[model samples]
Target: METAALNPVELEIARNRLESISEEVGTALIQTSYSPNIKDRRDCSAGIYGPDGMLISQAEHIPLHLGLMPTMIKNALATYGADRLVEGDVLITNNPYLGGSHLPDMCVITPVFWQDELIAVVANMAHHVDVGGITPGSMATHATEIFQEGVRVPPVKLFSQGTLRQELLSVMLANIRTQDKTRGDIMAQVAANRLGERRIHELLEEWGAERFAQSTHALVGYAARRTRAAIEQLPDGTGTFTDSLEHDGNQQRDVAITVTVEVSGDELFVDFIATDDQVDGAVNCSWAVTEGCVAYVIKLLTDPTLPSNAGLMEPISVTTREGSLVAAKFPAPVANGNIQTSQRIVDALLGAFHEFAPEQVPAASSGSMSIMTIGGFDETTGQYFSYVETYGGGQGAMPDQDGASAIHTHMTNTRNTPCEVIEREYPLRVEAYQIAENTGGDGRYRGGDGLIRHLTLTRGKAQVVAGTSRVTTAPWGLAGGADGKPGSVIRHGPDGDEHRESMTRFEVQAGEGITIQTAGGGGYGSSPAAE
Candidate 1:
């Protein structure tokens, strides 16, 4: 038998170059971005893709963004052909229906060509504080439609033939809340994309564009095969689970999520046939976002060595009704559904797996995106700034041990921005940034605890927004283990009274302190191993 041979030395170097582009792009964005979200919080991802838009590599950034790149690339190519895309022309979009997670997550993609031939595309996506709509932060729980959610930009050319699109820039700046921050962030994305294009061209010159493209395809397929092998290990049947969100960010009813996961010889199928239809609030998620969430869950338990690509998803089939929470339909506000809905799905699936494979599954992790948004005047510069902080909590203890504390759910791989950086960047003062003691649910093998973040508006006024879950229905423990604690957001109100809101976006006076407590992870099986 003859074996196909690939140069191991050249392949490793090409892979390194592919991933390094993201690192460079991340560093450039962090250094130049005007908002604390990008600078301090690092809510961004960068990647390099083949001209076909198949993701070749990524910097270890947000798994959501990384996993969804191929879809976005496919959409872009469908809209703009390779011949139409030219040098220095950049494309931007944030339409979930087209291929986006939310209304606020702005994605910029630029194609790279060498000697008039397409080589690759440099892509980057970041969370903009505001993109214009009824809400200041572009994420209101009451959003009923895509228009109400925020400005939705189809795949438009932000730059064409190496020239800036002044009209689009002006319109974007006017529609958004913070003009300075939004404009600056947009430019930052352009620069990072340019950087990636340059690096990719250099790679093309170094390792012949055709050869590099072949290698990318090879790498992607390798990952797909590895993922299939991982899926083959399950009990070769089906597992079912159902989870719920307390409320859909409105006075709306609770949102339910259901999954019928099938495992066969070397493939997995996750069906959301029983999930509730689209609700009236922003708690709906687009199909692209649903794919990201499912991929995250599969990756956590499956082969970590697999490259996240279309090939990886080849053996995995995911189905959901267009209007369900998992596959939010068109015109439904899905800005919040990507985060909240997906988190619950993760918890539910993990819970279901616990019954059959107790050792493979543990208790649920913090069930929400412990998010905080603070925007107001800065006393020092007398300027305005908004600081958004996303915190994580613990994963549930296993059958034999305790849960790990202060880790984000599978939805994110980002770290909490240091309090020092937060205070230094914005006018807010960090009073208490510590772990919430005794907040974890009690079990023989106790679950992990959450965090307590206290922010004082030392400035005159601040508009604060919070998006957290497990505030009512706490993280539940499994198989004889105790439950995890619930989360909350409390504000010292006008009359010195404490006001708590489930998913709040309100104003705070000078004397107010916003205290946000994150949810803990659930606990696993019985007390402990028989001593």
Candidate 2:
């Protein structure tokens, strides 16, 4: 099973199979999990990494994972030293500075053991429904630091020498609000990791460990070269784009972001130099997340055939201004950091790149995550429940075609929960769920249409924690296309009163109804002369 003797076609196939292992792990995490965020909202990612901490292959997971994961693996290796790991053990954490992006996003790392040698690590990171923060959903808009966010687990052994750590398990169950569900979700991640580990071992047995390791490295090198070539083709010059966050939870100040990309013969220099100061809100992000955002945009601009590993980001250089939203200082909160700002960063970089490669890039996308937090209880059944959902939006129109409507966008890969499933799981009713007509930005290729969802609070009081944009600044069109309509929210009270809602958290009392409408992306070009 020498590297050369093995069929090149087989080696490629093996790489693809390894990538699929990540998706399989994700499906397991979703199917057996207890929380909607894990099973329904689908805020998780599963991927395989080589012994050297570069991504091997993954099932098409969330866009956020693609940007943040390479660094996460590096953090894992740095913390554990990679040699102290053993068989039948799992490590978990959600430290923002470590392999984690935030408190809610729990990163689970397990080492793949092969004949008493360390070969690789199978890891899955998901947003737990609750982790004992100030809020039930663990989504606090006003937290000031990571400590206020939730439990900060780092590379701790859930299982040691093949035995479960019951004391640690008890502590977790006691701390989290959704105890039973969180416990089940944690085990689900462990199960998914084991599944991938078994598959990795099978591949090792078929090709032997040495050849497998060699192919892994070779594949990464191949991706890096291809990414570099993509950069080389772009005209040699520096271009910049800027966007903004409407406000922090304070809702009084606007946060800005500026990204300049220098393309010079196979090299890309990306810098976020004009961003604003960080705030005491859950909107700040770390340097790793910022780098991930840069990497994610390059992936969108590069050839899809290229492997998406750390190598693809190797030749590209990224630098950010200090005290900015992308590069937050310590003591700032960032529970929703990955979703709140990463997509905007991607959009900003693409905005500049489009000026150089119009044919290669599309117009602006649905620039916000339709994050909704709902809480209530079923009166007839008398069971308590509160949950949050981060929905996707329309994609931008491309050169050859129109964009998708009411779909996920930018750095997310989750599907909306079915109306039927929502009814069965909770005491809420989907009054209206359809495309918001006229929401797409008009162009030669029509922009994607956005979604409108109306629901009734049937039981008790419910709180909606919303953090979205495009309500103030509509999604922009390209090459003579019209701008898309802005997003809107309306709440109808029991007394037949209605109120327009802003982008913040508020309460919906019993007998009240709520409606949410998301915005669409802009089109690339104007329509051709009417037949």
Query: Highest lDDT, which number?
Result: 1
- How accurate locally, in lDDT, is each candidate? 0.78, 0.77
Compared with the true structure, the alpha-carbon lDDT of candidate 2 equals 0.77
Clashes of each: 3, 4
Model 2 misplaced stretches (Cα beyond 4 Å): 1-7, 376-384, 495-502, 527-531
**Local lDDT at 353 for model 2:** 87
Evaluate residue 242 in candidate 1 and report its C-alpha lDDT on the 0 to 100 scale: 86
lDDT of 1 by residue, 62-103 (tens): 877776667877787777776688888999988787667887
True lDDT of residue 108, candidate 1: 91
Which 10 successive residues of model 2 have the least lDDT summed? 1-10
Clashes of 1: 3
Error of 2 at 24 (Å): 2.4
